[model samples]
Target: MRTWNDSLKIGIPLLDCQHEQLLDQMDQLLEAMESQKGEQELRAIMGFLKMYINNHFNYEESCMALYKCPVACNNKDAHAKFLITLQDINHKIELKQSLELIVTQVKQELLDWFVNHIKSIDTRLQSYVKKSE
Candidate 1:
């Protein structure tokens, strides 16, 4: 249900685009759940997430490194934590835990984290990049 808004833009085109893609994927997963889709659809979303997140984080980290951003370490640490949380969610799903609960957790946690990251970490990166340019 989380949609990208202009307020979320970090003033970096590439990073903003990547962030939008992630939000789109998250929206798709949320829609699938709302539509009462089966596990297969959820699994598909998760599969896409695993690959997309890895690529996005790597690219972001590279950008941070290129600019020598002070927050690079913290950003990477946050990324690792998110990956772990995602894996734990997957494991819970596999264990046949409450689907609704899991979905709610994903909605709350991921959305919260994404928005906060963009505002706090990515915005700082954007400023650094702009200043460098």
Candidate 2:
């Protein structure tokens, strides 16, 4: 599981803190999934994310727009894709899918996507973040 670190910072404190919280949550979720205590924990984490992620995305998107960042559209697109993935995960849970499948899905869809988004896509915001500061 990936832990939050300074290397992940986008040069914005609020967004960086939100990203840290998300990384921490993802780590907890992954740990729980690995330990076979996933179902309840997954539900809780999903519930939390359902609320938190939207706010985070909105703030990030707004910043992108305000700064006229070149990656604004890509960031919005990625966020939409992530929301769909989250819905798909919830659907699978509702269908009583195997925990193993859910774990694989989360790892592939959520964890990997998030890390890559940060390192690649979101990193494009660094210049803007610096300018804002």
Candidate 3:
């Protein structure tokens, strides 16, 4: 199960909720792959995951902008790279690439990025919020 530990909190309620939803989608994808789900079901999930991520990332970054987070631009670039990588993942899935490899690679990369971004970059934004208040 994906976690929503306190350390992941960025003091933004909406962003935190979206983060939980994204993690839940990731968990569902992992479970589906482990069970060898069919293409149709996977496609449904991919559709939701793609749109949800796009929406979440865009909105969260906009929050940073409103807060005048200095790291917002840098964070947005990282988000862009992630979106590009997600597109590549979609391509690989469409081509029937090894599900195990794809799941492992994607999950690990995602978790690593989440941890690093939350611990370093997101925390910087939190500090900015604190300082601004």
Q: What lDDT would each prediction earn against the true structure?
A: 0.86, 0.84, 0.80
Compute the lDDT of residue 91 as modeled in candidate 2: 80
Q: What is the lDDT of candidate 2?
A: 0.84
TM-score of each: 0.93, 0.90, 0.90
What does candidate 3's lDDT look like per residue over 7-110, in tens digits? 78778777778877877787787788889999887788888989999998888798789889989999999899888877887888899999999888677776
Positional deviation of residue 12's Cα in model 2 after best superposition, in angstroms? 0.8
Candidate 1 has what TM-score? 0.93
- Cα RMSD for candidates in order: 1.3, 1.7, 1.6
By summed lDDT, which 10 consecutive residues of candidate 1 come out lowest?
90-99
lDDT over C-alpha atoms for residue 45 of model 1:
91
Sort by lDDT, best first. 1, 2, 3
- lDDT for model 1 comes to 0.86
What is the per-residue lDDT of model 1 for residues 32-130, given as tens digits with 9 covering 90 to 100? Answer: 776778888888998998899899999999999999999999999999998898888778767868777877977877767888888989888987797
lDDT by residue (65-86, candidate 2, tens digit) is 9988999999999999999998
Number of the top lDDT candidate? 1
